[model samples]
Target: MALIILAHPNFDKSFANKTIIEALENSKLDLEIRNIHDLYPDFKINAKAEQEALLRHQTIVFQYPFYWYSMPAILKQWFDIVFEYQFAYGSKGDKLKNKNFVPSFTVGSSESSYTALGFQHFRVYEFCKHLEQTAYHTQMNYIDPIYFHGTSLAAGYTPDSIMTNAKHHAQKLIATLSQLQ
Candidate 1:
């Protein structure tokens, strides 16, 4: 099964991420979804519960909107606290070994912005290298992420276009999970 840890601070304000999550729920996939922001409103992460959740699933997904070219503050906090020395790393931290890590995120900027000559000056995967390294250090398989770009300035996308993209996102996610199994 896949465990998706949604970390959007302002989930209601997101059009792309909201639609993508809805599509995932409608799909018949063996997965659990946890909106961390809703669960930990006070920014206090339940480390024991979170670590237990990670242990129950083979594929772990961090789904959220790209904020300032990185994950949301809440998710960062979760990583800082959840991935502790004795649990996720260090000598006895083999809990996450052989697990899969998939990061599904939405980028507000257009795809062109993530280029050598573009404003961001790097590809999406380049920005996500930290995540890959984390997976490696923890002995997990870091699958390439599913990305949805241009949400902030998606002027050309109609309602039908948006829904179509969301459906595609869900399909891709399901396929990714199945392959991992």
Candidate 2:
């Protein structure tokens, strides 16, 4: 089964992330979705429960919006709490070893803005070093990330267009999940 850690702060107000999630719900794959914001609105993450969930699944998917070139604050907090030293890295911390790590996200900026010559000044994958290293540290397989750029209204993407793109992203993600199975 696949476990999706959804970390959107404003889920109700989301366009792309919400659509993608809806699609995934309809995909019928064996999935356990944990919407961290809703699950821990007080930011009090239950490490034991989270770790238990992790142990139940082979594929771990981090689904969110790309915020400040990283994940939402809640996810970072979850990682800090759930991925404890002796639980994720040190000796006797092999519970997560060999799990699949997949990052699925939506970006507000256009793809061109992520280039060296563009405003962001780095490629998308260049920004994923932290994630890649996290997978390595946990002995997890780092699958290539699935992302959709130009998802913001400010970037001139209409709701319909974003939804269409989100559906496509969901299909691609579903396929990836199937491959894992």
Candidate 3:
């Protein structure tokens, strides 16, 4: 199975991510989509359960709607609590050593604005560095992220079109997962 850690706090309001996740959860992708906020409303993650969830899958995806240049707080806690030192980074932390970690995110703006000359003044990668580093520390293979950059700015962001793109992304991910397998 592929562990999909979904961290969209405003999932209900997201026209894009919601469609994406819904397709992922209901499809034949061998996925487990965990809504961080719904699982731990008080910011309390069950370490044992979280670790087990990680161990159960070969590929892990940190799926979220980008917020203020970072992920949601619940995802931060998910990392802190689930990715323990001894199990994920320490000398004995070989559980995730060869696993594949993918960070899938959606942005509210267009792709052009993420360039150095754009209004954001930084590349899309600058915001994703922390996640890359985190995966490296755990010895996981960090794949290039799956991004829907202009969803919010896209025309209407209708369910049909968003779902279409999401299905394509998921299919691409499935191919990537096959390579890892």
Candidate 4:
């Protein structure tokens, strides 16, 4: 089974992320989802429980909205707390070894703006090095991430369009999970 760690800070106000999660919920995939923000609103993470969940699944998927070229602060905090020494890394940290690590995120900017000659002046994949290195440090197989750009309402995107795209993203994610199984 796969474990999806949803790290949206303001989930109730989300469009793309919410739609994608809804689509996944409606699917028949054998997966578990942890809405971390809801689980730890006070920012108090249960490291033991998280480690146990990691042990139960062969694949771990991080679902969130890209913020400031990285993950939301809560997700970063989750990593800091949950992925502790002797558990996710270090001598006895083989607990997450051999598991598949996948990052699935939604970007508020357009894809075109993420190129070298574009506004962001860097490719999207470049931002994933941190995550890739995290997977490497923990001895997990880092799969290519799944992401959708142009998801912000401020980017002139309608809620319906975002919802439709999110559904497609969910379908692709479901297929990927099926193949992993």
Candidate scoring better on TM-score of 1 and 2: 2
Per-residue lDDT over 30-111 for candidate 3, one digit per residue giving the tens place of the 0 to 100 score? 7787888889889889988888888999999888878788888888888989899789989898889888999888777777
lDDT per residue (tens digit) for residues 51-84 in model 2: 9999999999999999999989999999999999
Clash count for each candidate, listed in order shown? 0, 0, 0, 0
For all predicted structures, in order, the TM-scores are 0.94, 0.98, 0.88, 0.98
Which of candidates 3 and 4 reaches a greater TM-score? 4
Q: Which 10-residue window of candidate 2 scores lowest in summed lDDT? A: 86-95
lDDT of 4 at 135: 100
18-111, model 4: which lDDT tens digit per residue? Answer: 9989988888988899999999999999999998999999999999999999999999999999999999999988999999999999999899
Question: Runs in model 1 with CA error above 4 Å?
Answer: 153-160
Per-model root-mean-square deviation over C-alphas: 1.6, 0.7, 2.2, 0.7
Error of 2 at 11 (Å): 0.6
Clashing pairs in 3: none
Error of 3 at 100 (Å): 0.6
Candidate-wise lDDT, in order: 0.87, 0.94, 0.81, 0.94
Candidate no. 3 TM-score: 0.88
